[model samples]
Each structure stands twice: as structure tokens, then as C-alpha cells.
Target: MSSEAASGMDVDGGAGRGGLTTAERTTIAAAVNAVLVHCQMASNDANFKAAIRARRKLLALPTTAQCLDVAAISDAVLEVCYAMGCGGFPWATPRWWVKRRTGGTWEDLRQCDDATDDYFKEKLRMSPRVFREIQETLSPLLQRRVTFYRVPLQPDHIIAYALYRWATGETYDSGTCSFGIVRASGITMVHDVTAALLTACPDKISWPTGLQKAVVLRAFADKGFPNCHGCIDCTHIYIDKPANANGEDYCDRRRRFSVQAQVVVDMNLRVLDVFVGYPGSVHDMRMLNLSSLWVRAESGQLFTGPPVMLPFGVRTNGYLLGDNGYPQSEWIVVPYGGLAQHPTKARFDNKQKTTRGAVERAFGRLKGMWRLFLRTHKCNMDSLPQQFVAVCILHNILIDAGVPFDDNLLWEVGPDGVRRRVDLGMHQPLRPVCMESSTGDALILRDALAERMIAQ
Candidate 1:
């Protein structure tokens, strides 16, 4: 007999009906109590409090919900949604690819097993509910008809579970089917749904000029940040190595080498722009140089050609906030530290230095939330950065949808008893530093001309 059976303990414990002796029952109860006691003790810890706060802030929602029962089928559907948001299974296609490339031609398909197609189809069949949900979500986003195209087991749940496990560094099974569908099906369904959701940008996202100014201004002056337009930065994510032909081109610029991405966010920590899937080896300055942002702004086409009123501050060759990675110019202002400052220019330099700190806080919020950037991602290099951009886009959607944020709950007393504005972008400090004292007061006198350009 096995050790468990020989000991007279129930071997059918997994099914939760193992008849056991009084001693066995006591051991199990003690084990359960130990876990509860440990948790109760840890709950009072300062680190746990900080963790709870950080989690609440990161999820952008309260965490007062109860534990989901095993039979909560609708809750399972939400779990499926979580799976979809994570990247779907990656290995399924490759094994299929190899078999197709060498084993048989498409004309001789009947002879070939074609495991990939069957696998994906089976996954879809098992999770009809999730598949249907994904289709529903995708239909509105794609602006095209989406009929269920089933494939064999994508093993999507396995991928999702693995990713979640890696991210949280916790043990979990992608193979668990708490939902109506099988584990793999649940995962596959969620991936499709997430893709659909990211593509679902509203027809009219309110980009009110007044609102932008108000929100930004509050996040800056009230929030103790500088150069308050928004925060800008780039990050990289790792994935499965690309095919040999495209391998070198796909390699990213990190310790482990992954695909890089660029994101721009407003002071409210809402993502405004995402430029993703560039090779990792490229520097931040290089990425910026190639970005559409650089293209539009550098060419002076932003204001002259179109009536696109750029966010925050007036045009007349308006300035952009950036870190030390960018080149210094009248249009794009970098932090004035290190050798960039001369002793004679200290007064004006201090002002510029003071304002640029907002972008740093913005970066802090971005990294603090989606910690996928905190460490290496273990998946396909090409698709990882795209996934990162997708997450940021999702974050922006949540923010737009009025999810609670840290600044929303916590209020700070501003200098001079001033209330910080969070309703719109009001807190951004005034720019055009040092120029106020320039020759002929030309920049100041010309400020009127600049206003005319802005009104245009």
C-alpha cells in the first residue's frame, strides 16, 4: 500500500472525501490553522500594508472583494478574461509549423495529421462560452464580422498560467478548469478576448482642451513634479527567440535582450501614446528619433500643416519635455544639469530644473503599476513589446473609464494653501524659462504673436 493509504489517511484527498483517523484530522486542521495564523500575523506587518496599498493603486481598484467559490461560473469567465489579457500560448504554432514545412504539402493535407489546426479547434469547442464571448468582444472592435474559427488546443491557458506564475512568482496551474471550459480552452478564449478589448478604442474619446490642462496642472504643481506636460519613457520585454532569419533584427536592448517599447502618459498616469516592437539594441534617443512624435514635431509639421492643437502649452514652436537622452534645442527641453549649465545661467537653469521632475514621477507611476517591466519576460521576443503596448493602452482605457487612482483618493496641501487641481490639467507650471529676461524682451513681446498662433 502507498504511504498515505498505509497510514490510514484518506488517499482520495483531492476529491475532498478522504476518510481519515482522528489523528489525521487533527494534523490537517492544524495545517489549516497554521496558514490562517500566518496570514493574520503578516496582515499586520508594515510591508504588507505597503504591498496592499501598492496593489490597490496598481489595479486602480479597491481590493475588498471576497474569495471566489469553485462553482462561481461567472467568476471563471473573468478568470478567462485575465488569461486573454496575457499573451496566448506560443508553442502550439511552432510544432505545427515544423510538421507542415517538411512532413507534407497542403495538397496532401489528408495524409498529414495537422495537429495545430485540430488542437486549436478542440480548445474552441471545449470553451464555446469563452470563444463566443471573445467573438462578441472582437466583432465590435474589428468593424468586421467575426465567426467562430475554432482551432486545436492552443494550450493558451498553459501559457497564461506560466506567465502569471513567472510574474507573481507564485505556484499555479494553467490546467485548472474552474470555468466551464477546459484549462487550455479558457486560456485561448481569454487571449482572443483581450486582443479584441485592446482594439476597442471608442469613436469619441473626449479630448477636451480644458480638461487636459486641468488634469496635467494638478498632477504637476500639486504633485511635486516638473516640466508637467507628461511623463515619457521606454521599456523592453522578452519572448521566445525569433526564427533564425529574423533573429538578429528582433533582439532587444536589455540585460537578457528583448523587444523595446515607448509610451507617453499624461500627468494623471494615463497612457497617451504607445510606440512598440522596436528591436531592443536601439537606444532611447534612437527610438525617439524614429518615433512618429519625432517625425511630426521635428519637421515643424505639427502646427503649420494641420490644426492639431498639441496638448499642453501653446505652439509658436512649443517645447517638448524629455529626459537627458534627447538632444537640447529650443523646441525640446532636456533637464539642465551636469555640464549643460553655466555659472552665469544659474537663475534660468534652476527654473528649468525645477519643472522637469514631473516626468520622473510619471515614470515611477508607469513602472510601479505594470511591473512586467520590473524584470525579464520569458516568451517570444517579437510579440512581447506589442503585448506591453497593449497593456498600457488597456491602462489608458481604465483611466478614461474613471477608475480610481492614488491622486484621486489622497489630497495634498499645496504651497500657499492652494488646492491642487485634478479635474483637468491645471497644475503644469508655466514654461519659456530664462527667456523672460532675454534681450529686447523679444520672447516676452512676441508672446502676443505666440497666442495668436495658439488660437489658430
Candidate 2:
């Protein structure tokens, strides 16, 4: 029979014409077997149907050859199998192309020997050395959780996916496509990586003590806020409106939905402590009051020493520089608010504002580095806080790695002293009750600091 007649009859099991030649029969069997194996089809009927469908689809495409061969048929079948969630081509696997394109090795996708240091720093917001270190640190902890039966999700892939999500705030589907992870796996990777970071990197967000506390104090002193250990402020991180009954509480004064994150940062713009998950409507001071830092400071556990003697015999505990949103206390210092400010008070306010800017700089760097915090994050309300804390951990990591802060972006503090995006208009009128009554000793310490500054 003619080749065309033979090819036509081949589909009908070669019943109407001479049976297919050995080579033709072998090619058809191979194509069917490939569909069965790659697509995981259980029945011969399903495998044959998939192979025929794939062949027809390829023939219908504009770029396809008018006639097909065994290799072409196998390629078409594999493409369809992959699309149907069966298996992936070697070049399309995250273990293969993602590593090779990003300058990693084929044998070990995590290695960075092929990439320059700047490539990792710019792309991953970490140096190659840091990435390697983190990979090693997290691998043991994450291996069991992140691995799937079909494929083992490497620690590098998990870390890269988390960093990419934090840096861009992209959706899970986007991440899957970018990182070669499936949707469900991508979500799990982010969750597992975030938990791993929080578990393994607590020091990054710890309270200062001993030599660390002394170092922080000295750094703030150099910025003209004497005996100051850190700057305190709260900024709103936008989030999707929760679907719960109390979702309204998440709306901020600006009428936007958000969650408040109160952060304390040292002069180096490293976050020392972070309290997150408060609804946006909560006042910054209220959030502060609820923080463990506040609890520790009020209980006298945060700092222990004879009251630090300042110039002119003023005695005070190490204090945090805060904006008007916070009340001045033995451990917290706020700027002067009255219309009639003494020259000394004005000078003090000036220095206080300048010094308190460290927290703003810290927030700016945080959002700028992990832009996921800038916009309304599209994550479950319960998971949002973990995401925020995860980014803060990464921010501290980058700071420790000496990644320069992006100071070009400016954030504004409202009249009530809460930090908000600059483009959001002025805050609601300041409320007197928002400023808790200052203690006699707290007031006296402020006056003494002001007088001492003027004297200096």
C-alpha cells in the first residue's frame, strides 16, 4: 500500500490495509508508551486517546510540520503531558534551567560559583556568601517539610521564592511560574521559609543587652540623642480587608485597610524589636503599650543600672526616641508639642526629631527593600503578621550584610505621630488624650535634657 494509505490505516489498527511495518509499529508503540509513562495514564484507552489528541493538537498549530515523525510525535505528547500536570521537561524543571540560567551548577543548584557576588546581592538582596550561609542554615530544618514525593524542593528554591515574594509582593501563581514551583508548593514554600527564618534568626529581631545594648546606645548617642538605645515608631502596612465580622477595625484613619506594625530600630537602621498584627485603627501608643518591649520597660527588665546621670545632674534610664504619638516616660522620650515652646525645648525637639528619624529611615529601608510591605498585601489575615515579621528579619539580615539603605524614599509622620505614606494626606487632628499625662520625673528629665543640650 502507498505510504499515505498505510499511515491512514495505522490509526485504525491497520485492519483495512496491510499492517504497519515493524518500524512504524515500534514508533507508534513508543509514542503510546511515552504518553502512558509521562502522563501517568492507567488505562491503554486513556494513553491512546492522549497521544492522538496531542498529535492532532500539534498538527493544528501553525508552526507544526504538515507531516509528523516519531520524535515529533513524542515531543508533542510530552508537551501535553506536562501541561496537564503530569511531568516536566528537563529544561523546564526548576532544578535544571533555573539553576543554569541564574549561574548555578547543574549538580548542585544552590552553588554560586558561576555567579558574581553582585548578581546575588542585586537579585536576591543578599551576597553569595550570605545566601550560601542561609541555605546551609535552613536546609536541615526545611528539607522534610518542603520535599514532595515527585520532587525535592531545595532550600535555595524555598529561600529564593520567599525573597522574591517579599521583594515584589507577587502572587503565588506568578511565583510558581517564575520559580518553577506549582501553586500549592509555592504557598507551602513561602510559609515554611518564613517560619524557618523566624525560628532560626531570632537574634535579628532581639532586644539589646550587654555589649549589644551598649553598642546601640553609643550609636544613638552619636546621633545626638544621648543614652538612647533606639528609635520607636509605628507604620501602617496595607492589607486586604478581612472577611471577618470585625474587619472594619482594620481600617485606618485614612479610610484604607491596614495593619499597624510598631518597630524599634537602632541608629544603624536595624530593627531591634517589632510588634505587628494590630488593627490599623489602633493608636500607635496603644500598640506600643501592648508590646512586650513596653511590658519589659515598665517592669524595669529592659535596662538595669543606676539612673543614667546626664549633664546638670539629670538622671534617667536609657530611653527610646519616639514621635508625638507616644507619651514621654522614664524609658520613652517624645518631642515637645505646645505652641509656646521654650528655646531649649525647641532645640530639644529639633534634636529629638532628627534622632527619631532613624525609625523612619528604618521603615523606609524596610519597605524599599521588601516592597511587599508597601502595598496592600494579598495574604490571609492570620498569615499577614508572619509575612511582615519575616521581612523585618530579612531587613536585619541585609543590614548585617551591609546592604545600603534606600534613603531616597521619605515617609511622613502624622500630627498624632504615626508614620504613614507621605502621599496620604495629613492625619486626623491631634487629640490631647492621645498623649498620656507625663510623669513628674519624666517631665523633669525632659527639661533637664533640654537645658543640658542648650548649655552644650
Candidate 3:
């Protein structure tokens, strides 16, 4: 029995679920009693009760207000803004109001706003607005493969509501649609979007280059790495406990709990593929093996043969770089030793270490660019990895769109020809592995890097 019920709280006495343990019952009972007390406290204030009654009457008689069309629904969404703990400031309020009240979609609202296109574009691209966008986009993409259900809020709405809660650490229902209109609009939840983001890569797509790639790709080529795809690695994102028993398995190397995701981005720093939702307990090597992505490549289901060359000059064929945690196979390469040094193995060690640098640079640039990713958030465990995928897609979009920053103009050159500005990312030490040194190890390292580059 739950501890609460064991204490004789009888929390579930009224519902009579009977299955609840004593502790569960007591906890529920306490929650019920707390709500009742709050209601009584509010009732003691006559004016507050009267105002609530008046609002209810007004809400019941809503057909007259033209603002009632979308505005009423917008107001309902705004109600969620408060529930989600987005309650601190006046302006921090959800901007969905602009689009909803103005009777326009996120894109249309962007055009009318005085804010920079990038600003509005980014806000609209966030989960709150992205859910709406996905619904519109998916209807055409899915066509008839899956049945679409219309709820008071659709799947996207549920997914958005859950994501808003996860991302903002806000109360549940922070992004929900109201009862009356939810059924009308037919909100598709985000899980469907998650599925798409994970599986949507067709045989090919064009990827663009960013500053990170400009540096690393050239560096790899200069060292003679041929057909070298970008680096591949696994990173962790924190997640709340899932209801499943296997949920705990997601805890990873940092020792703190997280879900693991593997990403393969090209030399251009565009993510070519993502293998996510692995349990943290699984080692990186095991997770990589389990992924259908690798299986397809090995079985020749993808790329029609062993090698997969991405559009941005990133190619994956017989080799992929891995850390010492993984096994060194003909298809996947790892360090010569497990972080253990030996004079005789120096050359092999240098080659593996240098070759792995490209992937590290991509990851460093990725985390540095997205401040949110620099830290972690508590997310609904099942959905966390999918959210990561969305972020990756957004990152690529930003790079390709060349989303300009206001600060870019701050770097104008002076009459003396010295530019005055700071671009932190421009000089953030090309990842540790990419750093060059004149130490005694340089010769051995240089040759090994050259050999790997030629194979690339």
C-alpha cells in the first residue's frame, strides 16, 4: 500500500479505486482536502466569487463578441500561459496572442510585427508555434497513411502542451486549446511530429556550410582526409522518469540520469542523421549497433551500397570515428588504446585522436550556438530526444537561412582598416582536438592525421 493510505488518510475513499495503496490514497485525500480548503478561502471573499460568477456568465454568453471568434480562443490559450508559470512579466506572455487574435497563422503574424524577421521567425519556430506549423505541414505529408483524430486538442496540441510544460518547467496544460474550440481545430499531438523528425530524411537533401565547417573541413582536407564525413558521437539530454520499467536504463556516463542520442552531421555541420531515444545505461557502442540507421548502411538498404555520401561533401562508407568506448571495427574506427598511452602505439593514437576532432568541433559549435543546450532541462522522458531532433532541424534551418544578427553590423571596419567587434564563436578554439601544437608529438600526430585524411 502507498504510505499515504497506510497512514489511514483514505485519500481515494470517494473514488473507491480500491487498487490504490494506502500511501496513494492518503496523498490523493490530502490533495482533495487542500483544494476544498482553497475553494472555501476564495468563497469567504464575496467579491471574488461574484466576479468569477460574472465571468462564467459572460463566457457562457460569448456569441456577441467578434473578438470571440479567435480572440476567445486566444484568451483560453492565454489562460494556459498563467498555468504554465509564464506568469512573471508583462511582455514574456506568450506571443501566440498576436497570431490568434489577429486571426492569422504564425507566418502571417510575423510579417505584420515590427520585430526583426529572425526574431519572430524563431519565436514562431519554437514548440508552441511549431506544433501549429507541423499540423498544417503534416496533413499534406501524411496524406492517408495514418488516421487523423480530432480532439478538444489534437495530438500536436497535446505534444505542445507537454513540451511547453517540459521546456519551461511550467504547469501542465500551459499550451492547451480550450474545450469548445479544441474539437473544432483538431490538434495533432507532437509525438507524430517526433516520429517524422526521426524518420523523415529521404534518400538525400542539400546541406549548407557554416563557419565551423569552413574551418574544420579545410583542416581535415589539408591533412589529406579523403571523402571524410563529419564526426559522429552520442550526447545525453536529461529526462524525467517514464512510466515504463525500462526508463531507468537511460541514465548515462555523466552519472546523472539522461536519455542518449547519437547524431551524424556532415563536414558542413548540418545534421545528416539522428539515432535517438536510447537508454542511458546502454553504452554508446551498443546503442550505435542497435540503430536501424547503421543496420541499413551495413545491409546496403541505404545508399544502395556500403558508402553513404551526403550532399555537403560529407561521405560515410567503410569508416566512422568513435571514442575508445566503442570497438574498432572495419566499419567503425576507435582509438588505438583506451586512453592508455604507450610509446609504440603513438602513431595510431595520434591518427585516431585527430580524426575524431571534426565531430567534436561540430558538437562544440552546436552547444555553443544554442544556449538552451549549454545546460539541461527536465523533460517528459519519452519526448525529450524527439525535442532534441527538432532543435537540430531548427539549427540547420538557421544556418541555411543565414539568419543574420543585429550584431553583425557592429563589426564595421574603421578608416585605419581595423574592424571593431567581437564574435565569440569565431575564435572559440576549434575544439580541443582541432588545436595544433609544436610539441614533440607533432610529427607522429601529423603523419597519422595525413593517413586518415587520405582514407577519407
Candidate 4:
């Protein structure tokens, strides 16, 4: 742009009294027009016609209007500058991307906040307190700095959008309508929220240690399982068939497309460990062996605490409880499973069932709270695992906050939230399963633990 053209829009939309002079207008017009004419925009560009009309309007503005508004004059000239730099006209912001400008989604979301706590639980799968805690916790990582063009969504709002979507399992299209956002922005909101949660999740979930390990051990001992650290279980997260060659592997005993998650939960139902991303067809024991937990355990890195002496001279440092889905190990105790169950073993199985109910109850509550696990997932296979882990972290967070679970929530939550499809372009081949039940120290530990339990 020429000095004359730049000077015409001087002082931030302020101009001298009276309209621009005929000669000054002529200079500005010629300079701006020269630039606009020479700039090449694609012939098939959506804004091509709008650009032509903008040019004609620029050419027609009366340079000699003595009473012209300075603001109008500035806008007129800058509009062309806008067109030259940006492919669209200055006013041509994409309609769908900018839907929440005024009395739209943001206001509606605010209005949905009634004084009671029920609204947040139903809408976000959590109470207001949990929501705020998460908002404050994720703010540092999720909050984006304001750019000249747009102010980012608040951490609170992003978390709400993502949580509500997960809790309700609504499709993104309908979710956009509910939230007053366009599909693209809604999708970005989920991504931003998921990323922040994942980054913070590792710290939220882990095996019991220090003071926590003591509390967990005492809690389980009181429940009739001595030296028990926690319980482990597996559940399936249903999904739509993948749009890939190996999509069939995700199908399981239910013959549904899904993935498996191996969760180890403490007595209080907080998720201590998570291993997900396997096809739903994989056996439970196979999933465990493939996990980092298994690697840590097999390397003698896990259960390093001092041993607890049991009946019959048996001892275990600490052990996890599981159902027959997993064979017994020195570090894990599973029940006897033959036609003629011994009275000692039968009595122990009853206790095992009761204690291991924590894992089953944990899965029930997890799926109940996060409707994501209730229905077939619509996200990428790779994305589903991270999102599952993220929600699990939230599960532990809510538990720590003393948020009570209402069994009725499962019946009350509405249809699934709309999910926009994501393709991370990754694949998993079915991993093979099983080692014969160990007759060694694992059998001795089980027998000792069972005998110890029946005696109690």
C-alpha cells in the first residue's frame, strides 16, 4: 500500500473533518485498486464473486462526500486490505465456526446451571465441586492464550463440553446444537480436553504406596483377604466397527466391536492401574500379561514389601485378587474351579467373590458414570484408550472428592453423546494368550490364602 493509502486510514479510524479530498481519494483508490487487481485469487475460490462485488463497491465509494463518516471510510478501505491478505472478505468469517458470538451456546450453558447439584451430575457425570476442581486443575495446561482473532474457551467450559458429551454419549452433531457450537469447534474442544486429562492422568492413578499402601492392606485384611493390595478385573468398551482391515479383531464373546480394559481398583473402587487398547477378543489373562504392570511384576519390581506369614508356613509380600479369568500366581490369588470343590476352597471362593466384588462394582460405576463405556464408541481405536484412561483418572478424582455414586444414574442418563470420528491410523494384531496354572509357589500361596480365609 502506498503512503497515501496508509495515511487515509490513519489514527485508528479517526479522520480529519470533512470527507477525503477528490485528489486524496483518487490516490487512495488508485493505490488500493492497483494492489487488489494484481493480487491473484483462485478462480474457483468460494469468495471470488464476493471479492468482485467488494472491488466494485470500493470503486463506487464517493471520494468527494464532504460529510462521510471517518469510521465508514476506514472500514471501506481496510475491507479491501482484508480481502487481499485473507482469502475471504473481512465480514466473511465462516458461519459455523463462530456460532457462539452472542446469545447462543455460552449463555445457554450458563442458564442450565440451576442452584442444585443434580444438574451437573446428570449433565456432566459429576457434581459441581468435581467439575470446578477439574477446571482449576487443568487450567494451567488446557487454557490457551488469547490471540488477536479469538479468545479461547475457558478451562471450565471445555471440561464441561467434553464431560457432558462423554456422560451423555451424544453425537457431536447434536452436541453442537446443544452447546451452540459448530461441529469443528466442538471436536477441537474434545481434543483439547482429552489431551489435558491424559497429560495429568498418570499422576492420578498408580499402585498404592507409602501411607496409601498401608490403608489398602488394612482395608482388605478387614474384609478377609490378608496382605491384599487390590483387585483386578476386565471390562469391554463397545465401539463401532473400525474402518480398517483389522476391525474384526475388536469383536468379543458378545460379537460386538469393542476393546478391553484391564483395571486394578483398590477397596474404595479407585482405579489403581489401567491397561487398555487391546481388541475385545483378547482373553483377560492375555491382556494382563501384555501390560506394563505384568512387566513390572515379572521383573521382581512389584510387591517388594515385606512378606506376611500365612497358615501352613506360606507367605506372600502382597497379592492382588482376581476371578478364575486369571490363573493364580504368587502375587495374585484366584479361586479353585473343579466339579467337586473342597469345603475349604468353597468357603474361600465365597469370600473371594465378596472381596473381588470391588472390581465388578468398580466397572459398574465406571460405565455408569461415564456413558462412554455403555454404548458403542464412535472414536478411533487409538483415541478410545487414552480417553478411557482419562475418564478413569476422573473416576479416581471424583472418588477422592467423596462424590457419592447413585446407581440410578445409569437409568437416568440420556442417549449417548455424539462422537466425531477420529482416525489415528494405528493397528494392533491379536496377541496370543496363557501359561498353564503354576503348581509352584502360586498354588501354595492360593492354598495358604484360602485356608487362612476359611479359618477367619
Number of the top-ranking candidate, with lDDT as the measure = 4
Model 3, 178-257: lDDT tens per residue?
Answer: 21223212224445554554455332232224554346455544544433445567776555555565645755544556
Q: Which residue pairs in candidate 4 have backbone atoms (N, alpha carbon, C) closer than 3 angstroms, thus clashing?
A: 168-417, 169-416, 169-417, 170-416, 170-417, 170-418, 171-417, 171-418, 172-418, 239-377
Each model's lDDT comes to 0.43, 0.71, 0.47, 0.73
lDDT (10s digit) by residue, model 4, range 10-83: 42234734445666766776776665554434324645666666656655655543323343445457656565
Q: What are the clash counts of all predictions, listed in order?
A: 35, 0, 26, 10
Sorted by lDDT (best first), the order is 4, 2, 3, 1
TM-score (C-alpha, index-matched) for candidate 4 = 0.74
lDDT, candidate 1, 396-435, per-residue tens: 5445545433432122245689765321111222232343
Report the alpha-carbon TM-score of model 3 versus the true structure. 0.47
Residues 1-456, candidate 2, lDDT per residue (tens digit)? 644453544533445555456587567667666755654443356656765677677666344221354345545556555534433322234443232223332123355476555555555667777777888988887885321123465677778878877876678776655666667777888899989988998788888788888888788766666777888888888877787738779888888888888888898888988999888999987897888988899888887744667775777778887777777778888887778987788888988888877776777788866767776666777787897898898888878877665443345466899986643211332653354478888877778778777767
TM-score of each: 0.44, 0.71, 0.47, 0.74
CA lDDT, candidate 4, residue 103: 35
Query: Sort by TM-score, best first: what order?
Result: 4, 2, 3, 1
Task: Decide which is better by TM-score, 1 or 2.
Answer: 2
After TM-score superposition, the amount by which residue 71's alpha carbon in candidate 2 deviates from its true location, in angstroms, is 31
